[model samples]
Target: MGSRICVFLRRAGWTMWLAVLMLGPAQFANAASPDPSLVAKINAATFEVVIPRADNDPLSYEKPLPLDLLPYQERTDKYFSVGTAFAIGHNHYVTAGHVLLAAVGDLTGAPALRDANGHVYAIDKVEKFSLQQDFVMFSLKEQPQGNAALATDTKAALNSVVYAVGNALGTGVVIRDGLYTSDTPEDENGRWKWMRFSAAASPGNSGGPLLDQNGKVIGVVLMKSPNENLNYALPIGVVLGAPDNMAVMDKRITYQLDVMEDTQTSTFKAQFPLPVSYADFSAAYMKLLYAQGDEQLKKLLQQQGNDLFPHGAGSNHILHDTPELSLFPELIVRNRSGQWSYTGRELNRVPLSGNGYVASGYVGHNFLIHLRRPDDMKVATFYNDPKQMMDLILKTGYWTREVGPEKIKITSLGNPASSTTYTDNWLRHWKVFVWSLPYINGQMEVFALPVPDGLAIMMRMNSSMGTHDSLADMKALTDFFNVDYGGTLAQWKEFLADSSLLPEVLRDAHIGFDYGKHFSYDAGNISFDYPSTLQPIAPDNMLFMGVGYYQDHGKFALQPGVIQVRLNSTDPDRISAKRHIAPSPDLDDNFKEAWGKLLHKQHPYDGVPYNDGDEMDVASVIDPPASDAPAELYTAFYGTQGTHKPEAMKAKLKLLTQQFKLKTH
Candidate 1:
């Protein structure tokens, strides 16, 4: 009973009502074919204009804004249904002007037409358009087979029976019967007449052909009116009679679409989060790496071809990347034809909404992603380090993870000569370091490559969430890129030196130790000093010596372990009194009974007993040992669990043992 006119934007899940009244008898001699035959022929020429969308955009669920003054809404998808357009001339399609304007926001790709045969063709250019009258004509890149006829006798009597044909609810072309109610002036001036009809025209039905009882096209459906049983269509006579309307178009129409430049490029599609094809990959890559008008990047893309992406996702839904975190933003290939091999199998996956096919192709175990925003360069730099970069990327919300350093074969490019001294050169020039840890989800390895223009590639091992360990496969990938960089160490260094985004300092702050920076642990009764930086934990029932910072991936720390120096006040547990204790004793015994093993083989200094055991030796000291009273010191060293290896633990234990001493206050 109440009515409000709404523009069609392809919203799904709404029922439409249609009304048609028998036209007042106005017999015309030129009425053509039977309704059924004409309807069949017209329907074949109709097609659905579809725009490719990401899985995340809710194209079909959008609703009209309740108010007019609200801020304009934007969608992330490339295209959704605009009011339907039909082929009117060879390779020419026409649609409501408003519909085309609303659908092609910041166009990333051209709108495509899917005909009754399900074949798609790209819209090339606007041939005609008029904002005042609401109509647009465009040419298609691909030739269409047929076109619909425009009525010669444009006038329709009141109450004429008519049929509406269009893509309703994006399902397909549907023909609905309704009544031609009356004629009304288009604007306040009444310069032209608009045909009013009761044929149900729902969202996605605008710009379709309106026909008479004998199936001759009469008008173009444009919009629903705010009155019951009233819909408006531009008269066919108005469209066909005005020659100037055919050339009317807005000259400033621009789109942001990513499409193939030519026919030579083939396409390859995989599951979601993966590129649809070679063309899709190239288009996305070129968009991020090049500025809006960079011709050099375009040339490189055309010349490089598949060489740019030598690796492909195979059968596996999961793609394992190189163990190092550098291949993410960009891959630097030494040879133009370099390719990658991965261990994964392709499998069929059901298509998601909007996109129907989950095509099978190369699925890798890792994701080498590259992302950039045009506004990122506006800031000095988005992040200071790889950890900061990762934090910024995952900033959709706040989250954290623990990490630690791991050693791997590091090389720049494919040069073996530069590989001879890879470790030092890599750490200095590339800022290449590996941080690994057991994340909240699973094991992960992070590799960061400092690229130009605030760009970086973060390669990680076993990065895919919810997937089991793929370290073995990741190692193979890492080895491939390690030797893939074609440039020498000097050339790489020069590039980093010249890049605006690379930090001035390249040394990693989390690895190695300066043994000259001594530290002391004073426990009132017993105290000593070690050569390296070791912090002190309060002496408990057993005195504990804390060394280096070890937290959340061991950032800003090196060779972390504890030096426990226990004061066994009882003589029976003292090492000086028990020289006959077994040379090789139990390691699990408390510090009181473990003194023999802690000091088993060294010479004494002055009167104090000392033994720098093979497993335990001297560390360092900033100051001489000091105490308030004579204290019997029994020491044991232990490394933290997990990646803490025994050989590394033994080295630290020897340093602590030799540095262990008891002083009289």
Candidate 2:
């Protein structure tokens, strides 16, 4: 299972793992009914917390269903019931902190209270909040008159009968009875004990009141243990003892980066005066939380120091190795041996309409997605239509959400709420899309790389990931991602022409061609051209552009360092070329020495054309006019049926580099 991430990129969420369910209604466990008079008093004090549904929200599913399948109020309701809250005093109301958080970043609406007779009350101020204890204290703008507050019992005896009361599943006040079980320690240092009872609490029971047999409030219902029917709640005593008019957060977080196995645990603590409106509280909390994320990320990187990616012993081999030729979207993770390598092929693949397919699997906190176009789909349409692409992906690999036993397949995501292409430090361009998921109170972030086959995507969502700076985190991880770019001649044409979809650098490194005639590839500092005579062009002929990071450059350089044009998709007969940059000190000893030999022209194969038997011809030049010391050699080779001599290979090299119009960066 992935981190339940319906998080952010530029926004927030360092999503975590917990059994606690979200805003969905909780189950109510019935052990015994509470006193009838007490029930009436409690009902008047307690109100259902609801976040109004957006009027503009529309869900497009795979097919239409019978009108009766969904309740009329559910489909046409103005508000969505999340949890419950009740009066603690004349105007003071209390609910689980997580309940208010649903409003923190929500655009649909802030939380409000709904009475038994269908009246609504707006939340006025957040008097207090605590993340760890999962509680929030606030007041209503227009408090209901004559609703008596529920009395609190700070020292209720363990093993006594208690009533779990709330607007069970939004059907109005319902009280269920269960024995007050033994206390359970809080997760972080056991700072406090939670009241655990064998109450059959369901989803909607969260934030409700857990009362004693006398109907005195003892604790606030939070979550049910996923393993058993027992439930957990914050002892009412803790809430009463907490200082007034303050917001405090003390939660333990395990920092997890996607590229490595290392983790660091730290407690996030912050405090500030409250009694602020929902808007002010949300803004303040987001600022502090995002800042905390940045600090923690920086601290973790600092703690690892040179042992992190592109620095430690693990990255040495990958830094020196040529671009990984495989185009599947996969993470570059540091293996147990302390060597960085691409995640393997144990991914889940699902077929799409056209022969196209999507593959996905976990990589640390994130997941990698590769969407390949079906052979029958037009390259241009598939490459440009991101909405269609994502729709296909969601329908297949991810699965549809269930609406009443009917699995509703998402038909489309419409347009991205925001779209921008970010070029990472290594110069890899990622098309970023943030789809507003207002219905869920978050956004679906996507960072997609345009590859030859299709899009290589990253980002977050798995509602459980629970908020963090998802955008910034994914962008940060982009540098460690390793992939190649390859496509057929037809794919190249469509991909290159769509300037709206092109990355900054790719626009300059134009892949100019004419179906079966002249073809050329240009990089910022190098250019190569070869006529169709070398390898006749067909729509299916593959062009594999190897991209690698040259860290020796002041800023890392990720470009098409090597090029191979093969005959059709399967034929080995091909033409290849590379303009190499000499390695820095980190490379293996043998590699450095071998390149040194080539630079000095000591070996026959060094800058010398040769036929290495397999009917393959090769030649290399240590440094052409535009290249310098660190920029070592340029080579071009071809493999054909007929035996070729040194002269033939040199001719091809000259043609490839004939147009040396490279502007060295």
Candidate 3:
């Protein structure tokens, strides 16, 4: 059976508590009265949450209001009992996020909780929360008279007897007992652990404290699984041991609430804590667009169409067409057949008829995922640690520009979360970072996920600075992201190999490249493997075969690197078959011809030897098995000594000899 969360709130000064009981301590068989001292502290420390009474209430924890509204504003008394929460840290109380969500509809108001003594304290602000873990931490506007000590250890022995304390069905503060059975995985990422118990808990028991024999809070009751008697709680250590500090002024969010009548499922709207500003969008967009060592990204953009970027510069409309658009709250994709298809996945329960929404923005394009990196790259550098990765982005100027060192605001960092997904072959950890980019005038995010035995898969999402509701859209994109983790190493290598980046180097490493079919140079009676990266340069006025064959030229130019070659043929001995030629007669008077296939020691100046300059190899008939047919000349030019390696040139010359065929006249 599906799991049900237990958390409730009331809208008045009087409050009550209930928690979905997870593993609880065993009740004494003799059923004697509990220790008076412990009970007194429990009664003093625990409080009942007050919320509005609504039939089939949708559990939500945000009190969304206009920006002008102050925190904890006044509201009417449509109040009732939610689950229980107990004070822990200095003036702070902890409870399940879902419980507080019950009274958190579209209104802004301070929710009060009443202790056993009927004294009430207002919840001041949400300090921290974990959506994956289902917990929320907030402080009291005024400190309570008493509070409970929290447990520090995360481990609980199997079958340990624990007490499940909560406001049972709003009757009063009640403590039940159950055995801590075992731990279970609660999320797809397998990074979080939940406590399981046999406690007999019902609706009003959620968000209450699960205490050990010492009465120290160990876990917070969450919900129960419908399959059996097992209930679940989040470990108290996890709630306290979260990775980030509670430093932001406000940590609450507005959510569109949905609750199923059967109580089988529910969905709460989620949004980014801060909207993406335009500067943030520009910075992130430029970084991905100009990412170092990302040759495939360029090709992928090219495949879509060159018109997307006119004259090598991105158009303003590009902001809407880029991959970052996937992070939008509303993403509509156009299929290959020219028909638009809705690819968005909702985080809510299965949609019932007309209640769902389709995202808006740039509406007619496909989101192609670039999920792998080069094999030679270190995967650890991507996201082994979240902060380090952020530092890298900052260093790359992906977030903010570096002008003055004193302008750095380290304390500005906030909104950190870890997401993960696991399959039999892979365990993926996505360290998520959300921040405002003043330089780009927008809010941006980075998802650094490492691949096993490969490079890191980094994805970026950006949005306008004022638009904060895009979590649902991001979830849909992440669902699409999971598909690539299952991609094979061969695919990644092939993707790199297919690009114009060091393809030959990858091939030498046994990562093969397919250059398609060889272009026939029928005019020169020669054909050989040509790199796919070479582009045909026009010969508007260039001379080849007395200018007659210029239109049928067999020459091409390499991009990103300057190098050129032309395929032409002459009589068998046009240049020289000799291995070496002494310094030219114009430069050195007395020199002898050395015999070999390549002619060596030639200079461009013809009469001068400048900066180790020399004329390279001249193709000729094979010396060992001299051929009788016509031999084509393979002449090449190199601007620098190191621009092209001599051994590589030799290989190309040798390949031409092997594959070159002489067509009979």
State which candidate has the highest lDDT. 2
* TM values, all candidates: 0.33, 0.79, 0.34
**Candidate 2's residue-wise lDDT over 503-561, tens digit each?**
54576776777668977877766776778765676787788887765654564556667
Descending-TM-score candidate ranking: 2, 3, 1
lDDT by residue for model 3 (463-530), tens: 22222223323333332242111122333343333332221212222212232323222323223333
Which parts of model 3 are misplaced by more than 4 Å? 6-34, 52-78, 147-153, 244-665
Which candidate, 1 or 3, would have the higher TM-score against the true structure?
A: 3
Q: lDDT by residue for model 1 over 1-665, one digit each (tens)?
A: 11222332211111112111111111112223235556556755566665544333211111332323322322332334444666655666666665554333212344566665556677776555555566666777777665553333477767878877665554455667788988888653576888888887765567777878876778878778655557788887777665432333222211110111222222121111231222343344234222322333244345544433222322011111212212123222233223333222223233323211121212233334332212223223332344433433332211221112211211111111111111111121233333322111112343333332233332343212211123222332332232112121222233345444333222221111222354444432244455432322221112212211112232221111233322221211111111111212222344334433333323222123223342222322212345432122233333232343445644654555466554432
* TM-score: model 2 vs. ground truth: 0.79
Candidate 1 Cα misplacement greater than 4 A, ranges: 1-34, 54-80, 89-92, 103-106, 146-152, 187-189, 226-229, 245-665
- Alpha carbon RMSD to native, model 1: 23.1
The model with the greatest TM-score is 2
Each prediction's Cα lDDT score? 0.39, 0.71, 0.40
Error of 2 at 531 (Å): 4.4
Between the candidate structures 2 and 3, which one is better when assessed by TM-score?
Answer: 2
Q: Residue 258: error of model 3 in Å?
A: 14
